[model samples]
Target: MRKLFDDHKTDLLVFGGLILAYFLTRLPRLDLIPIFTDEAIYLRWSQIMAYDASLRYLPLVDGKPPLFMWATSIVLKLFPSLDPLLSLRLTSVGGGLFSMAGIIFTSYVFFRNKRISLLAALLYLVVPFTFFYDRFGLADSLLAAFGVWSLGLGALLVQSIRLDVALILGTAIGLGLLTKTPALFFLVTLPLQLLLFNFKTSGWKIRLVKLFLLFLLVVIISQAIFSILRLFPLFHMISQKNLEFIVTPAEFLARPFEFFFNNLKTLLTWEVGYLTAPVALTIAFAFLRGQAVKQNLILAAIFLIHLLYMSTFNKSIFPRFLLTFTPGLLVLAAVGLDQMSTRLRPSLLVLVFVLVLALPVYTDFKLLTDPPTAPIPDGDSKQYINAWPAGYGVKEIRQFLARESSQYPKVTIGTEGTFGLMPYALQLYQKDYPNVEIKDYWPLGETVPAALLEASANHPTYFIIYQRPDVPPNWKLRLVASFQQGRSNDYLRLYQILPED
Candidate 1:
């Protein structure tokens, strides 16, 4: 044991430092970004699943798979006293660590260099796209972890044709598929791994037959796990909801290039924002260099096809969806960095990496300290930092209501809408507060309703509005507190409904 430790001392130190860096970025300030609309829904589902077996498949009603909720509910059950959203975020932290380990292992397999393995993890750590998701309480992080392991093991299976690798790879793909539908890309790109197969070896005919047989086993295993969803009646809703986000192949063929260029432009713009142009250049450089050409091409094809397919057919696309491609891209980028390092002096190599990684590191800093200033895509900024859907003032609202609840027999809280951030967020926060009665109101006319004024006459009633910019002065209400939702013009305003003058 002592000899083993001594032999791998440098490797241990490098990985140790990488793990420290990962936690430093992931563990702190988890509440920095407030709950999002989807988060409110997901966390609520997790809360439901944890405490009630009757509602275990609640998310399936909304066309979401139940695995992410099941995973999160375990955290909630384990730490019953922890904040609900915090528990959910910790689940994603586990997933991020899984992907980081996969990056280290897969990079070593492809390049056989310890430094490249370290560098790939470092890239995943620093890139804002990954950094943002790792700390977030979302299914995408776990889904990406499964996708990374699937690709890594698939690459190994093609060369080794081992049954153990095939079975493990199938499990990885199955978990990924349960997490999200994007795991289909794993099957779509599996054929590319054929480039790594040992066709030059004797008895190639039998080898090909064995490979196909194992591939069938993989399909059977993955599909069998997926079929568990069929026990629930709403299993078809997954495909139905999937169509809402992506265009059908026939639909795309009808207008082949209508959204292609614009979507690609937006996606590449986001890529540069998070990954940095220099790192992207390095990924390109990996191909130009002749080393590990087969592995490089396979990884590149997997990532490029994913981007191209989404760009060509997406009805709506967000940067988080691009996360599944990160492990592959970062590993490929690590290859380029490794190739460069081999030709350069140590001092020059350090200088090159620093220059290539500078932008992503700066972006991470902004995300950590001042999220509103981060260079994320506008859609992400709107969803996470600066818009009505973002839960910027949710904590403050909860605190205010909790304080008010102590003074009243039953504190009635009204929000702008019935769905999403308004009602769901407050619902999750006040799970144990039975004295609180929450209601939702929408389509506020030119003036506040007389119904509220009548209620205000008896006692002070509070209302929270988040959906719009306009506040009617004629609403017979006095402002209690107003919070700017990040840097946006949008504000979450709390008002005390006043009696008629």
Candidate 2:
């Protein structure tokens, strides 16, 4: 057993097996949740892409990138129906599975220890947050997969200065950027690494200058190609949103301290929630004392820079945004655990095992069973039936709708709050009912009644209202069913041209 543990090859296989098991557990349960709002957008947009050329446009929320939509477009082409919860979500699942492989490979490549890489893989596979997001229809998992690969390639280039590695690194970075605009955080850290790596080379200044020009060239070329394909849609959107989103230099200058403080707080809130103080300290300690000082420092810088960027937004910093930094944290956490594994005596194995088992159990219980605080002022009512699409209800809702419903020419679903998982679910369910009509709306929006009104005009027989009871009484609708448990609730309401009342 000791000898087996010592062999990295064996450890890698063991870890890979465990990850395979993890993916299996989640993949089979893919469409378990009701579709959430953002997922609805992606599903609808991608479905539009299936027929109309104009609908290929990028859908940006909060200045985020168009990569997820672009990827979703590709999946829609393959499946055609574009099931938000199942078909579309499967892409994320595949991306996540590959990301697990990337995590293990990147750790092995960086730390050069099978055990440490395995430890990192174990940490990633076991984390409930990681698993929850992995199965959902989102760009986070896809971005993370590419992000880890980009960072690994960049780090490898820094160590070797090989032209081929640099080219590959550049490509990965470009793809990552394409995945999410925030991936600029990784790209930002690369040149610094290049300068550090080549500080001793002949004509260091020339090398730096050449590196800068090459970086610009690669960026320009990639953007130009994507621009032509996206037809400069993203740039146009930026120009359109500039008045609303852009901050003046004077504003930033005037509140420099306050800006920095607030940004740091937002970043820390989600990060700290995921990693407790002890884990944070452990990762920090490893950075200070680890052998790969330069690489670790770069990782730390990336984490800090991203936190700083995310903090500037005035909106509430969701914990899911932390997904962008998952690869970095996972790598660092692996290093931290490896450091502990080595420093601790072999006699302490049992104590470590107990800690390992205890943590994930506690986290899973909290994530799966504990309902989130409602979006409403009164905690008695839940705004969203589920915050994310990783529960028994989510899956049940998908299957029930898939099995029971027949396709309509057009249909709109009224939902309270943002139901990110619905579009994906509809896409999957629609496979069995090709003529299904599905559109999404948040009940709080002025547009909620528009769908019901449209349905009443056409008198579409089927209605799937996520918050049926909570929908305003003014809306011409009657509830057929309400799915509720604890504080959470979802409903299905139907409407007609003539009021029964």
Candidate 3:
């Protein structure tokens, strides 16, 4: 043990610093940002599943796989006293750490260079796209972690034909699939490993047969684990959700070239370019210089396969959906940086690295400190707030409800949306307050619902309007508070309904 520690002391120190940096960025004030609509749904589902075993299938009913919610339910069950939002976000933090470790491992596997490995891991830690999603309670982070580890282990299996590595890789792929549907793309790209296989040895035919059997075994294991998801009656909903976005086989056959070029343009220019500009620039440079051609080509093939599938699918796209490809991009970028460093002096290389990474690090810092007002162009920080019923006024509303509950026998509160971030946000926090009855009123343009009107006549009723500036003229109400994102109204007008004589 002493000999091992002495031999790898430098590696240990580097990893320790990386881990410290990861937590420093991820752990502080996790609950400070308002809960996103998706976060609210997932956390609420976990809360339901923690107390009731039968409700484990609840997430599947909403066309989602149950692994993340199931995992979060276990955490919540163990630490019931902890805040649900914090505990749920901690699960994502674990996934983010795993993802960082996987980037380091995958970079070393492909390039066999310590500088590239450390640089890749550092890039993963600081990038705005990874940093923002890592803090939120989402399955994409976990899926990325599993996907990267599976790619690394799969590469090793192809090189050594080892059964143990095959088993670990199979388990990683299975877990990735269970986490999200995108994991199947990793499986689709597995044949690219043939490039890494050595053909110089005699009896290459026999080796190919063995490799085929091992690959078959891995697929069987992954499918067997995936079959567990079929136990739920709503398992079919997964296919339904997939069909909602992607074209069916018949539809694709008819319009084989439909939306192909446009989707590719959008993905390359906006999604990948905006979120990972430094990495994108490095990849372009590496391709032009013709360094690590074979490995770069293999990584490119995998990324292209995943991108083609995503782009062909006809639906609205999100940046988080591109997360599974991020580790591969970072690895390519690290290789590019390492290749560039070989031609430069040590001082010049350090300066170049600092300049390359400065923008992403600054973006991450601003996202953490002042997220609502951050200048990020394409991430959850900017998009989620403007698009969804985020919990901007949730903390204040919860406090007001707590105070008002003590004054009135029962305080009825109405929110704009029913199942999204609006009601779910209050529902997660106000689960203990039975006297605080929260209801949802939908269709923003419609007049106030009769239920709210009746509630206002008897008790201290309050309406939390998220989208509209105008209120019904008949209701005697006073605006208590307003929450805005920058100058735009994210949430508005916590109204206290006045009593009528």
TM-score versus the correct structure, for each prediction: 0.95, 0.76, 0.94
lDDT of 1 by residue, 109-182 (tens): 77777878888998999888888888888899999898888878887887788999999988888888888888
**Clashes per candidate, residues 3 or more apart or on different chains:** 0, 23, 0
lDDT of 2 by residue, 1-501 (tens): 767667767655686697677666567646544455566666666666656766555464334466676677777787764454476677787778867887777776666777767766766775655666776777888888877777776656655646676666666667776665656666676664653464776777766666666666546644553454345435555444443543455765776554557656655755654554444555764665648886677677877777766566423445666776676777787787777776788769547645654555465444444534312112112222332232224445445455444444554443333444444545544556454556655545433355456565663433454433454545545554445433444333333323234
lDDT of each: 0.84, 0.59, 0.80
Segments in model 3 whose C-alpha atoms lie over 4 Å from true places: 253-258, 273-275, 288-291, 379-382, 444-447, 468-476, 486-489, 498-501
User: Alpha carbon lDDT of residue 184, candidate 2?
Assistant: 64
RMSD of each: 2.0, 5.9, 2.2
The candidate that wins on lDDT is 1
Q: lDDT by residue for model 3 over 1-501, one digit each (tens)? A: 999999999999999999999999999888877777788999999999998998888988878888888889989989988888888898899899999999899878777889989988888887877887788899999999998898888888888888898888888888888898878877778889888888999988888899889999889888877878899888999989878778888988899868788877766765554355766777665576776687788877888887887788666666677788888888888887877888789999888888888888787777777776655554454556654355676777788888888787888998877777778878887755669999887765445567777888888888887766677667667888987743355555688766655
- In model 2, what lDDT does residue 361 have? 45
Identify the superior model by TM-score, candidate 2 or candidate 3.
Answer: 3
Arranged by lDDT with the best first, the candidates are 1, 3, 2
RMSD of 2: 5.9
Cα deviation at 183, candidate 3, in Å, is 0.8
Q: 267 in model 1: Cα distance from truth in Å?
A: 1.0
What's the lDDT of the predicted structure labeled candidate 3?
Answer: 0.80
